[model samples]
Each structure stands twice: as C-alpha cells, then as structure tokens.
Target chain A: MEEIKEQTGHMPRIGEPAPAFEAVTTHGTLKLEDFKGSWLILFSHPADFTPVCTTEFIAFTEIHPKLQKRGVELLGLSVDSVSSHIAWVRNVEEKMGVKIPFPIIADLNKEVSLAYGMIHPGQSKTETVRCVFIIDPNQKIRTILYYPLTTGRNMDEILRIIDALQTTDKHGVATPANWRPGDEVVVPPPNTQEMAEERLKQGYKCVDWYLCKKKL
Target chain B: MACISPDGKPTESGTKMLRALQAGLKSPEEIAKETGLPLFRVRSGLRELTQAGLADQKEDKYKLSEKGTKLIK
Candidate 1:
C-alpha cells in the first residue's frame, strides 16, 4: 500500500489545490485549468460498461441540470480508452435512452487517475475505485467521498454536499446532520466571552452560545 | 422522455442573467449585484449563456442576444 502511495504521489486532501492534469476526454483533450472558473465534481469509476457505473452515470445525468443551475460541472474518469468511453456512452444513450451530457476522461495511460489517487491497489490494481472530488469555483478541493466497488452512490447526498459547501461559503455557517436547503443552519460559535453573551440575545434558535441555529 | 426533460429552456439562473443583461447590466459584477447571485455564478452563467447563443460578450461586458431577448417575459 505504501508502495502504491509512493507511486500515486500523495492523495489530495480537503482544501488542497486539485492536482493538475491534461488528458483525453470524450469532449476533447482537456486540462484541469479548463474548469477553473466553475465548480467541478471530478469523479472516477472502476471502468466503463459496468452496471453500477452505468446507473451512476444516469443518476449524474439526472442531476446535471440541477447542478448547472447552481454553477457546477461534472467530469468522469476511468482507466479506459477514449473509444471505450465513447462507445459506452453511446450504448447507454441508445439502450437505456439516457443522455450523458458531460465529458468523461479516458485515462488509458492512468496518469490522470494515479495523480488524483483514484486507483486503489487493494481494491483492484488495474481499475479506479469509486471516488468523488467536489472542487470549488476557485479550484480548491472542498469535499471528497469514496465508495466501495460494490455500492453505488446517492445523487441526493451528492447534491446535499454541494448545497452544504456553497451555503457555508456564502453564509459563514456549517450544516447539521441531514441538512437540506431552506433548513436552519448552525451558526459559528463566538470566540470571545463578550460575543458569547451577546449571542444569546441575538434571537437564534439557541440551546447554548456554542450551539445555535439560524434561518438564512 | 428522459427524467430531466430539458425542452430548450434556460435555467432559473440563466433566465435571471438574461433578464439582467436586458436591463443593461454589462459586467458580471453588475449582473450579480442586480440579481443577488454570487459573483462566481454570474461569471459561469455568462459563459453558458454565451455558449447557448442567448448572450454575447464584448470585452468584459455581456449583452443579451436576440434569442435571449425573445425568452424574456
């Protein structure tokens, strides 16, 4: 595992600049900088023509417009050739009749996948594990989620995270468990004692100064 | 039809941006301020709106194209 880690370089953490790359995508050759001004969800599947990945693609497509309305773009990746990616996307569209409206990276060389630490040696040396990287508009890695090979991802959870991250950035607050849009958001705790005393009188739904929820 | 039936309609943000452009908001900052949207969102929306041929950009400013003007109620 350490050897694989050394080979893949360090796995990117939250708050790091996304590792840069230029690679062949279904849309065309694309670079990481191409998506700089937009919020991006760069995800990696194990392979193309797989059942779980297919369902995920359809689900992702289902949310594409919703994400677009919120200023987000989707990019998929795998250690497959451009032809394979193209064929599979077309097959899904023809067979399942679901249009995949995003560019997918064909990482046949695995340079992009390894750089993003998408490949898990323990899971499968040849394939990337299910991984999701939610990058902000500033190109900062905001959130990362990894699912096992067998399990598919939830579209609702994906949308929820984007909402949570965007809300936190816009309103300077954190989300509580199972947060949805229009729900009360948790306010940041006051640092100074003076502010803490004033926090109670501020009319938030407060159990204590450290724990307060407010409507945005 | 698919689950998402996008019948060539502009999204809410896209519509707000088109409306902003029609109201003579030129720069992304101005549009963002007018529509109460995030500056980044305004910038991104301008790119998409331009790509969709509903808006045009000259220098740093944007204006609604004829197609965009037709969509505004």
Candidate 2:
C-alpha cells in the first residue's frame, strides 16, 4: 500500500512547463537553453551507491544510443556527493561493462529535489523517492512517473512512451496500450457525424470508427 | 563511452560538478557540446540534478539547486 501525502513546492504535471534550474554536473554547468528543441527524460533516485539505484542507472545508459537517436536526453539525480556519483559510475562501468553516459546531479542539499517534488517526506526523510519526468523541447512537462523505493523503473516502457509521444505529435494519432513503433495507432474519436462517415472510408487500419492503428 | 564532461563546467568529479552547480553555473549548450553527448541528454541530466535535492534550472538554464551557498557540513 502506498501512503499519500500533501504535495509541496512546484509540483510538475503533464502539459505544464517544467520548472527551470541551473546546476553543476560532471560535464559542466548546465542550463535549460541547452535542451531547446529536444526531448528530455529527467529522473531522480534516493541516493548513490545503493543497490537498486545502481542497477537502474546502468540500464538507462545501456539504452543511451537508442534514446539519443530519438533526440532525447537522460539525466539522473540524488542527494549524494559528486564523489558518490564518480564511484558509482566507475562501479557500474567496471563491473557491469556499461558506462553511465549522463551526469548525476549531486543534490547534496535537497533544494532541487524539493523544487521538483521528488522529495516525499512521508515516504522517507533524508532521501528522495523514484520520480521521473518526461519533458519536451519546449520545456513543457509532458509526462510524470513516480515509483516506490522498492521498484526499479522499466527502461523499455520509457522508450516506448517517448516513441508514442513523438509519433502522436508528428502523426496526429494516439497510442493504445502496449503500443510500439511500426504497430497500429488509435485514431481519435470523431466528434461529428460527418467525420464518422468519412472515418470508415479513410485509408487506416481501423478496427472501428473511433479506433485505428498505423505504422509510426 | 566516456563523455569527458563536454561543457568544461569544471567539476573535479561528478559530485563536485554538482556542488559547483549548487554554488552556481548555468549554461545548457556548453554542457551539451562539452559533454559530446546529445543536447537532450544534458537537459535530462540537469533536471535530475535539480530533482535530487542538488541543483536548479532557471530562465532556460540550470545552476546549483541548493537554496543558497549554505552547505550542511
């Protein structure tokens, strides 16, 4: 069972512009302007050097090539020291053979965590829960995902969602459950009788008037 | 594939980069070019940095998210 608590501080939502920030990273000082015209996948974990977070970070990097091809960026966050990020990156690369390709925010002070609503005091003190934000090139908060401390997020699902979002925006269609690229898409429901009549005759994989699937 | 901190924001280590951010440094394109990684990757990285109680982004850029220069230690 999950315990819910009152939200605090600049909570993000789908379709909302994401809160902005400037932070030091392994590479250098990073600003939001850097991401203009690109998609971003921002995520947070409780801490560095932990077993679960370590595995997830490695997995995210594993799909870096694929994500990049899609024009998406990946960043990780936790209230750990830069030293911890370095050690964890080394451990993941050395033992697992996958290098962490992105910077991990050393939010040692928790200011950034609170701003993004990543810190859930009800869940735990002195750490953040698993929170993921899918931001678009416009800096809009396109999607949000929160996971419990016990669960590790699925990278495949994430990439799938990105594919779905980009596809929908590009093609003017929606995604159905378990949707994948090259699969059929769902046509938005027609609001008028005229569209319904034309919908059936249109060249789409229409299971019915309101539902259709198409290749991405 | 080591990214080699493409932006040259001057982080001695990943953690130190974050610390310097907490203190302040906000440039996105520099981060991308310096990292040799994708621009989106840098944006996502900055977001994560802020969400984890460490950094912040503003006016389309990011700086150390810590509320102030006040280090707990």
Candidate 3:
C-alpha cells in the first residue's frame, strides 16, 4: 500500500487545492478560476468519438440541469483539439439528438491532463483514462474518481456527492453509508466524558456514544 | 430528421440568438453585438441553432427557419 501510495503521490488528493489551469475550450478561453465561485466537475475521458465516452456525454447532458440547480458546472477535457471536440459534440447532437451544453477543454498539448494526473501510463500512454475531479466552490478538490478506459461513470453517485457535500456543509453532519438526502446523518462524536454520557440522554439515536445518528 | 431531440429545450444563448435572428441580425458578429453575448458564445450558439434546425445560414448571415419562426411566434 505504501508503494502504491508513493507511486500515485503526484496526483492531487482530496482537500487539496485543485491545480489551476487555463486553456481554450469550446466555450472560450476558460481558466480554473473561472469556475471558482461555483462547484465544478472537471472530468476527462480517453478521447472524443469513442463509444463509452459518447454514452457518458449523453448521460452528463441529461443531468446537466440537475447539476446546474445545485450550482455545479461541468467541464470536460481530453487531449484533443478544439475542432475535434466541436465536431464530436455536434456529431453527438446530430446523431444521437443529445446536446452537450458544457464546454470541453481542448488539451492538445496535454498540459491540463498532465497537471490533473488524468494520464495513467498503465492505462494508455497518449490518451487520458476516465477521471473525475469534484471541486468545491472554494477551489478545493473535494473528491476524485478514477475509472478505467473501458468503464463509464455513475451519474447518480456524482450527484449524490454534491448533495452529500452540500448537506454536510449546511448541517455540519456526516452522512452514513449509502446515505441519500433525508436519510439519518452521523453526528460528530463528543470529546468529553460528560458529553459522551449526556449524548445518550440527548434526542439522537445512538448505537454508541461515538456512533450516534441524527436527522437534520 | 429533427435537429433537436423530442425532449430538447432551448438554452439561454440559443434563445438569445434566436431572438437576434428574429430581429434580422445576420452575421454571428452582428448577433453577438446585438445580443450582448460573447463572440465565442455566439459562434457556438449559432452552431447549435443551425444544427437544431432553428436557424438557417445564408452566405455569412443567419435567419430563423420556419420552425424557429413558429417558436418565436
């Protein structure tokens, strides 16, 4: 585990500030700071015009409105040119009738891909594997998900992350396993012995002092 | 073939460009200037509108298609 950790140490970890980058996208010249005020999902696929990526793009489009409602913006990246991205998006709209509303970065130079560690040498030397970076409004990397080139990502889990993050931030509570909105939340454990003893008498449902559950 | 999907809705930029076309704005630059959208946005919106069969490009100018006209009406 230590060897694996050392090998992947260059990749940004959760709670770290996301690496800043600026590049031309289908929307325009956009920078990481451009999305600083809103939650951003910065994801990368292997390449354009591929099968799994196509389905993923369509799925992302279907969830774009939901993400926007939660104040999250989506940005995609690949080591393809802007023209290729445009053609591929247009092709998707034309062929599949699904419009991609978000901008995709044309990281032809692979600068942004390299910075985000999207390129897995074991996966492919030239193309980026599927990687998703969930960044918070404060420009912090909140979560990172990596999928192999053959697999697509789960849209529900992506939305759930945003919901979980927002709910926890607002209520100062942690989510339990498989916790969806409205499910009971895990309460922060008490530090003092008196508080621990009193925790049981409090209104929360406690499996133990350290494992109390509450609804916010 | 229908340009937009059955469940498709017009995006904000798409609507603005459609309104600009309705107002006789032709070129993308003219549409951008009229709509107060960025040039890049206008370009992309035009592409989407054209693909969605909401706008027609003639020479360097764009005008609303019949479907787009009905939409605005």
DockQ of 3: 0.06
- Across residues A69-138, which tens digit of lDDT does each residue of candidate 3 receive? 8989899999999989999999999999999988899999888887888888788878889999999989
- TM-score of chain A for the candidates in order shown: 0.97, 0.90, 0.95
Best by TM-score: 1
How well is each residue in B7-59 modelled by candidate 1, as lDDT tens digits? 75776767787888887639877887898865644665676677778889999
lDDT of 1 by residue, A61-170 (tens): 99999998888989999989988999999999999999898889899888888877887777888888999999997889999999989999999999999999999999
**How large an RMSD does model 1 have?**
8.4
The C-alpha interface RMSD of every prediction is 9.7, 5.5, 9.4
List per-model TM-scores for chain B.
0.85, 0.52, 0.84
Which candidate achieves the best DockQ against the true structure?
Answer: 2
Candidate 2 lDDT, A30-91, residue by residue in tens? 66566678898889998877889988987898888899899898878888887778888898
In candidate 3, list every pair of residues with a backbone clash.
none
- Model 2 gets an lDDT of 0.73
Best of the two (2, 3) by lDDT: 3
